[model samples]
Target: MSINSVKGAAIVTGAAQGIGKAIAIRLAKDGYDMALNDVPGKEDLLHTLADEIISQGRKSTIIIADVTNEKSVVEMIKRTVSELGILRVMVANAGIALTIGTEFLDTRLEDFEKVLKVNLMGVFLCYREAARQMVQQGTWGRASSVNGKRESHRDEHLIFFKEKKNNHYRAAAEMKKYGITVNAYAPGYIDTPMARQALSVNENLSNEEIRQQIIQRGSSSSGLAVNLGTPEDIANFVSYLASEESKFMTGQAVSVNGGVFFG
Candidate 1:
């Protein structure tokens, strides 16, 4: 179909609010159509969110799926292509935090399973389905994806790069088959309502003490002592990766942690 949308249609899971919402909005402003997703009942504002995009002359789709389900995840990509025509970007931003007070000794096995299922498994299913759809589209691709491609022994391994999180390696590999590129954004300590709630649980400490401790811990991990990051910081980073400017950059996590986790 030649990818008719002006920018592209992106599938962003967890786009109901917070960092996910910010990323969805940023991509829309850059001219991409949106397929925003959240677990059923977690979001009720898609009508309002979609209205904002139509106002700018773009289309929006809402998909409610438990991304951890293979069947449900597969259907999401299929419908996005069938409805939106092409799914150029897949942002697997849907995640849930581990229970705050659930210590290993006190935590139920079910809770641990719940966290991993929704997090790691959800990410995998979404990436797999998106890659499958990209392959069907028959787009052009780079050298690493061509027929009978191989890297020589002399090619740099750069072992340190293996541990990073932002680059969508699995998704990108599957994308390569379909001449598509997949990337991810791994943000740190973003200022979201969810985070605020987490931060408030330690009520014994005053706000100043808590802030100082947070800064101290962040400074240790990050090279700089910069304050907690805003969701917009992550939205900006997501925009660059989703655009053509990042064509050469794939399989990279590109930390936006104010120097907390460097490349």
Candidate 2:
């Protein structure tokens, strides 16, 4: 599609790899020019993804910024509008999962803060900046986040995931007046590098063992599907949420976890 014929621009944070990369590609295929964002070191990956999007006949730009800093996020939004077009979709997918298997008592204060800073505070900044731009443009927009649901067992990192989910609801409620919708996708046991890293906390476990653990965890609840979901699964759902089809949905943390957790 030509630039004039494409859907409005979108900013997908954490677009260097895994779910973020998948979302960017899917959005490009769905015909939105993309602004891909990640931290400093992932320039190569972001550039490659941008090239792929451009090859698909859509405009793409790489914006490297730390989401935790307010100024950085502001610049990210500014650059997206300047480089791509009006900000119509913001996928606040950039996040970190640290100290995953560590006990709450053993977790350091700084470690806990780091998790919240990236997972919680980062999403807040992305949503806030994107909403500001959308409202200013006087146009309808979509902002979707990738989050995790609360589990029966406590993982320190899950706290921030829950908070991220809450942030989506609060942002959705507040941004509705401006014709902007905010929502989240809660994925369970997706086979992403991040998921592998979280499960690899035990060095003794083999890759197959870790795979089995993910499958088992995803199927723990009776009558649920047994296989782990792919990044494309979440991306497909996000495609709907980012489009006009999901106009009535907002403030919902929709579960894309193969029935592992009902929303």
Candidate 3:
């Protein structure tokens, strides 16, 4: 849907900064009320955003949550809805990752599990809870709504890259019955705080030398103008997907990485 068409409150997780913050603020400017979420110390960052939301005269509630924690996620959604009224959009944007140096055989088993838990499993739990709430809201939202699907219809075919695919897709399938579309946007080369940290720490190259590598990659691909994309560039595309305009689309893993990982 067009920006003007997206109304009501949206819950943007990991929103104290980066693409999450960009999405939250962009929605506020579009007249959608907001429910923000971040880790504990990021309260101050959200406070600044809450002020910006209020300055635009939209409603807001800031919540601290860890998406990987099921208990924390459930409580976060419950409080956000109770305080903000309804949840139209759930971003599932919170993720934890690292560019660990350990080789495959040398890596601790915990490293792989931790990454899978937070990045993959966390998104599953958030979608499960948010879809339940958002689906109920979606019914109240429009006309000719269908009832929840039969249990057998919940199956969704998904690609398996590393034995983690079906797990997340199963959660997404549950989300479909509620008219709440769920999808993941796999970002590539958009400069966030996390990527910059990894880039700066490269022992094999100077910071400027590493920066040039990133620039050359993006600029050489798909007509990238500046050679590096800002978080807002990713946020803009995500904003469209989260809106009602993308009703016919769901369960996609879109890559915004210039020309990376093409089939």
lDDT of each: 0.63, 0.83, 0.63
- Model 2 misplacement above 4 A: 1-4, 154-162, 201-209, 215-226
Predicted candidate 1 versus true structure: per-residue lDDT over 1-263, tens digit per residue: 12344666788888887888888888888878888888877556766777777776778889998988999998898878877776677888877654333344665667656755766677777767776666666543221110001111111112212322222466565555455665556666566655555545454655455546556543233345545677789888888777767776765545566654455
Task: Give the CA lDDT, 0 to 100, for residue 254 in model 2.
Answer: 79
Backbone clashes, each candidate: 4, 0, 1
Error of 2 at 128 (Å): 0.5
- Cα RMSD of all models vs. native, in order, equals 8.1, 3.0, 7.9
Please give the lDDT score for candidate 2. Answer: 0.83
Compared with the true structure, what per-residue lDDT tens digits does model 3 show for residues 1-263? 44444376678788887777887888787667788998899999999999998777788899898878999999988988898777777776775544523334554667657766666666667767777777766642211100111111111112213334454455556566666566666565555665555444455554455557655544233344333456777777777776667777765666665554353
Candidate 1: misplaced stretches above 4 Å?
1-5, 99-107, 140-171, 200-226, 261-263
Find the candidate with the highest lDDT and give its number: 2
Model 3, residue 125: displacement in angstroms? 1.3
Candidate 1 lDDT score relative to the true structure? 0.63
Model 2, span 227-252: residue lDDT tens: 56789999999999999788888988
Q: What would the TM-scores of all predictions be?
A: 0.76, 0.89, 0.77
The worst-scoring run of ten residues by lDDT in candidate 2 lies at: 151-160
In model 3, the runs with Cα more than 4 Å from the true position are 1-6, 100-102, 138-164, 200-210, 213-227
**Model 2, residue pairs in steric clash:** none
